[model samples]
Target: MFPNEWLWRNKLIALLVLVIVIELVLFLVPWERF
Candidate 1:
């Protein structure tokens, strides 16, 4: 119920979303030159 706890949860969710987006871009891109 604390505000700090709520903020921390939001931060974690944002981090997870960012990671997923990065993974998707990497998978979708066809950069075989690496």
Candidate 2:
């Protein structure tokens, strides 16, 4: 695989993981305290 392609793929995977984490946090935390 090309280096640039590998880098982009890694970035996409990282972004997805971050989104999932944020979603989980929002779902588990109470909204009234904010």
Candidate 3:
């Protein structure tokens, strides 16, 4: 609920982004048929 806490949260954001990328590359996108 605090903006300052979020603003200083670099590791959380990096982990979030890494998780999103892994999901997209491993489980979501069907890149083989293209």
lDDT of each: 0.95, 0.97, 0.84
TM, every model: 0.83, 0.84, 0.53
Q: For candidate 1, lDDT tens digit of each residue in 1-34?
A: 5799899999999999999999999999999867
Model number with the top TM-score = 2
lDDT of 3 by residue, 1-34 (tens): 7788776797789989999999888777777887
**lDDT of each residue in 1-34, candidate 2, tens digit only:** 5799899999999999999999999999999999
- Report how far off residue 10 is in candidate 2 (Å): 0.2
Stretches of candidate 2 off by over 4 Å are none
The candidate 3 region of ten consecutive residues with least summed lDDT is 1-10
> Which pairs in model 3 have colliding backbones?
none
Ranking according to lDDT, highest score first? 2, 1, 3
